[model samples]
Target: IPKTPLWKRCVQYTDILGKRLLKKIRLQYLQDNLEQRRTARSSNLLSLCRPTISLDPIL
Candidate 1:
């Protein structure tokens, strides 16, 4: 059996941490985008169901 060098261990640890961080960030971004799309879709449906009236003196 052989022991790994200290620098190699550190590099491996950093790589793992960076990957986990990136995964978390990507997941969060996707969730936020999905939420935004859902809200936009709901608002569009609501607007379509309601009639818009313009209040103008000339009209």
Candidate 2:
């Protein structure tokens, strides 16, 4: 039987590497978005509590 060509190996490696890079970029974007949301929630909670704490002393 005949052997396979070397060009096929290069094509396969290129496709695999491209997919792996895309997956990594997508994961990083998701993590950054989650961190932003968490920060916003904490700041909102702090602002909501400020008014109640300030008014409790007079009432």
Candidate 3:
């Protein structure tokens, strides 16, 4: 079989690399968003629970 030409191969390689890079960036973005939401939820839960915890000692 005849091998593909150099320019087409380069284009195909670059296209694959670009897609992989974009996927990596999107994954990182989602992870950061999830981390931020987790932190916020934990902080909110702590704030909500603290007063109840202090009240429990007096009860």
Best by lDDT: 1
lDDT of 1 at 10: 43
TM-score of 1: 0.41
What TM value does model 2 have?
0.40
Give the TM-score (vs. native) of candidate 3.
Answer: 0.41
Better of 1 and 2 by TM-score: 1
lDDT of 2 by residue, 32-51 (tens): 66788868845465656575
Give one digit per residue, the lDDT tens place, for model 1 in 23-43.
665576678777888788445
C-alpha RMSD in Å of predicted model 1 compared with the true structure? 13.6
lDDT of each: 0.58, 0.56, 0.57
Clash count, one per candidate:
0, 0, 0
Off by over 4 Å in 2: 1-17, 41-59
